[model samples]
Target: MKLTPLEIKQQTFEKGLRGYDVADVQAFLTLVSNEFEHLLNKNKELEHEIEKLTDRVKHYERVEEALHETLQTAKESVEQKMDGAKQEAKSTLQKAEMEADAIIKEANHQRQQIRQSILRLLDRREEIINGISSYLDNAKKSVNQFSKDDMGTFKLPKEEDLEESIDKVTSKSSYSRFELDEEDLEISSYEEEDSAFAPGSDRLDDILDEID
Candidate 1:
């Protein structure tokens, strides 16, 4: 059987005539038990320390694993966020380009509309100018016709009579002593009457100048 310190201390050898000295044996057993007990206590203490160190090492390993996982997760999250931001920026840029194209197209359409309106206005202006020109031409024809009628009513000199009057006035006149017969005076009166009405002859010419 196993022996404890107490058992070793209490153990007795049977008495014999010449076995061993009793006091020396008991003292030696006592000494051996004390030393063995001290060794056992030291071993237990070392085992406890080893257990604590093992637990600490496991804790550190767990912490390291958790930190690695967290770092990996953070890196993945950052990449995902960057990808999302890039896609969003691309989408926004495309939308802005489309809007810009639409705005340009609308501007071009509006410009075309304005050009068309200007063309229409120019056509209207041309029509107005043509209408006014036609009206003025008709008015000139009417005025010329009226003036011819008035001349006919006034019984103005014929071409032959006017030529005869010019010959008479120009014939043999002395620059220093000019004189006139009854015929010459009569012709001179007719010419004065013609001169009095001469201002009305240029109405058609004035109307033509305005049209030009």
Candidate 2:
């Protein structure tokens, strides 16, 4: 059977007439018991150390798993943010294009307004020139009626006032210098007042209404 330390100590051998020395047998047993006790203590210390190392390994594995999960989550979050940023960029670009188109359309409308104003100025200038021509023709036919004093009293017209007044002339149909029949170049001048003026006075209010 197996011998423990206490059982080894209790073991006794029957003495033979000269088989073994008494002191030698007892000394050998004592040595064996001491060695066994030392080995048992050493084995227990080694087992405890191994368990501590195994626990440390398990703890490290848990920490590594947590860190990996965190890294994966961070990567996913970054990807989502990038996706949102891309969509926002696209939306911003679309808004910018729409704004640019709106600005261009408004500018085109303003340009058309300017072109119409220029055309009106040209038509008014033509009418004023035609009226002046008719006046000159009438004056030539009634040259006897005009005295030298009357001629001297006639003022040299102010350039700014004459151009501005021509732009306001309402009788453009009655006094058009433009010839649809045959285009030609000619300059003319006219008196500000005449008897052939039809209805009431050509008031400033009427001119303002035509501009509107």
Candidate 3:
């Protein structure tokens, strides 16, 4: 049967001849019951402490597990962000390269167009210069032939004829500013002044100088 501290203290024994002393035995039993009760209380307290310690250990284990999971999640997130950043950088670089190539291509095309325009301008300038030089040579030849004529007095060409010739020569050139008009010719009859027709006359020389 299960025996408690109270039961042990309350237990009774039958008396017999030459048995133990009653008072002494009763005293020893009381002491043993008290000691047993104290031991039981101490054991109960130790068990409570052990239970609390076990609960704390379990709580710590759960916390450690949660921390480990959090760290793992953070690591994965960082890696994913890094990968996204790398992809973005690569895309940006490719776009920039394409833009640079397009700009360079456009610049080269514009440069070529400018070069062609310059060449055309140079050719046009040469044509105008040649036309003006040819016109001046023809004018000089005509003037020399007229001076060598056998006429007694030097006769100037009619104003209308001179104007027509000038118009034809100036039409092929861009130097309109150099064109001469009738007002600038100052042509008149030389019959009154025979010296004007002389070989060493300054009048003819002055006309030729004005033409030049």
Candidate 4:
């Protein structure tokens, strides 16, 4: 039968002619019962302490697991962000390089156009200078030739006489812008064919060819 501390303390023994000593047995039983009760109480306290310690250990384990998961998630997020930043930097660099190249190309094209315009302006300036030089040379020749020709008296010639002289000289290759009307042709000259067909006439032809 199961025996509790109280049951052991209250147990009784049958009387006998040669049984163990009653006082000694009863005293020993009482002592054993008190010691058993103390041991049971101590065991119960130890069990409760073990249960509390186990709960504490389980809680710490859960915290450690959560911390590990959080650390891993943070690591992944940082890596992803780093990758995105690198890609963005690369794209931005490429765009900047393309823009710089385009600007350089445009600048080069503008420089080429400016250079061409300068060259064309220089050619036109040279052409104008040559034309002016030729005109001056022809004017010098015509003046020298007219000085050699025999001029009449210091008086001006009549309009009809001037017209007749101009008609005889202008029978060859013609010129523009030098068309002398009645008033403009009132210059005195010798009435001879050789005087009319002198260096002045040839110089005039040269001037007209240059103009043409």
Candidate 5:
């Protein structure tokens, strides 16, 4: 049913009255077959080239898809790493803040303790100073009373009597200028020998020694 180039070249026409010239018709048929065969070969070449181009396009599409997937995976991995780093940093920061707060609290507590100790020391010093001041005031009052009593009751002997009394008692015994009451006279005479005792000098010394 289909006519190839070879079939067209080999075709023949039946002889009849007023029929075309056989040689001319055969020559034309040969020329048409050759031209058609050339056209067919060119179409086949074009089809082969189109098939090669199509295969290349499919390969390029596969490569592009693979690149897209790789990029997406890389982006996700980067985001995950960044999030992890952020969380670690936040945790570290919180820990540092807590530690700092604890240190500050401890320091404040120590400072309060030190302050309390200083206040207690100051109070104790004040108490000691007050006790000493009260003792000294009482001692001063006792010394003043003793001086007034001595001035009122005691008298100095004459220079001639004093020299004679000193010579008389030099080898026998010592004497006190003070005349004590009957209850204290014996003890005072035995304990005290200095007739030149000043008003508050020896008495003040005794009181200070007692205090000590």
Candidate 6:
């Protein structure tokens, strides 16, 4: 049984012949009971302080875990955004390369067309030159065929036959340089005629016979 300080002070033993001193024991017990109550109250206060410190420690641990989780989430978001930027840059580079290649191909095609046109122009110029050369040759042959005899020698005009005829024709108007040279050659050949007609009037008549 627990003893109160008041109960310990109240209890006293009577001392008769040869009995121990009971009053002194009761007073000492009262003092010891009061000291024990004081010690128990102080121990209870220390236990409450320890419990509160433990709760604070638990709260701090949970906060540290939440901070770590938030840091990891932020790092993951940054990495994902960087990867998307790299992909977009790669696609843009590829598109630029394609555009450059298309431009080169178009330039090559235009160069080929220009080369073909130049070749065609050269070929057409050659054809025109050949046609003009043929026409000049034919015109030279026609000039060789002109004859004083085909026009017929003048009948009974004078002794100097071809010169007199050319003079009469030119008196109307002047003839070209070719006709003037022909008349000069015929006037030089007046001695070649014996009967009434000459065998060869001049080299002009000879040239006319060769042409016919």
**Candidate whose TM-score is highest:** 3
Indicate which candidate wins on lDDT: 1
Worst 10 residues of 5 by lDDT: 193-202
lDDT of 3 by residue, 121-192 (tens): 788767656655665565566567556758744678899988997898878766777667765543433432
Q: Please, what are the lDDT tens digits per residue for candidate 1 over residues 94-188?
A: 99999999999999999999999999978877866776666667667665654665445577789999999788777855643666688989998
Q: Write the per-residue lDDT of candidate 2 for residues 63-178, one digit (tens) a residue.
A: 99999999999999999999999999999999999999999999999999999999999898676656555655665545544434465557767999778768767547765654
lDDT of 6 by residue, 4-107 (tens): 55665677677779886666676677777677666667767878877888888878878888888888888898898899889999999999999999999999
Who is ahead in TM-score, 2 or 5?
2
What's the count of clashing pairs in each model shown? 0, 1, 0, 0, 0, 0
All candidates: CA RMSD in angstroms?
11.1, 18.4, 16.1, 11.9, 8.6, 15.6
* Residue 193 Cα positional deviation in candidate 3, in Å, after optimal superposition: 19
Off by over 4 Å in 3: 125-212
Candidate 5 vs. true structure, TM-score: 0.51
Q: Single out the weakest 10-residue window by summed lDDT for candidate 6.
A: 193-202
Screening candidate 1 with a backbone cut-off below 3 angstroms (N, C-alpha, C), the clashing residue pairs are none
Q: Relative to the unseen true structure, what is the C-alpha lDDT of residue 46 in candidate 1, on a scale of 0 to 100?
A: 92
TM-score of 1: 0.46
Question: Candidate 2: minimum summed lDDT over ten consecutive residues — where?
Answer: 183-192
Over 3-76, each residue of candidate 4 has an lDDT whose tens digit, in order, gives: 67898888889989999898998999999899989998998999999999999999999999999999999999
Q: Candidate 2: which stretches are off by over 4 Å?
A: 1-7, 118-212
- Name the TM-score of candidate 3: 0.56
Compared with the true structure, all predictions reach lDDT values of 0.80, 0.72, 0.78, 0.79, 0.79, 0.68
Question: What is the alpha-carbon lDDT of model 6 when measured against the actual structure?
Answer: 0.68
- lDDT, model 5, position 74: 91
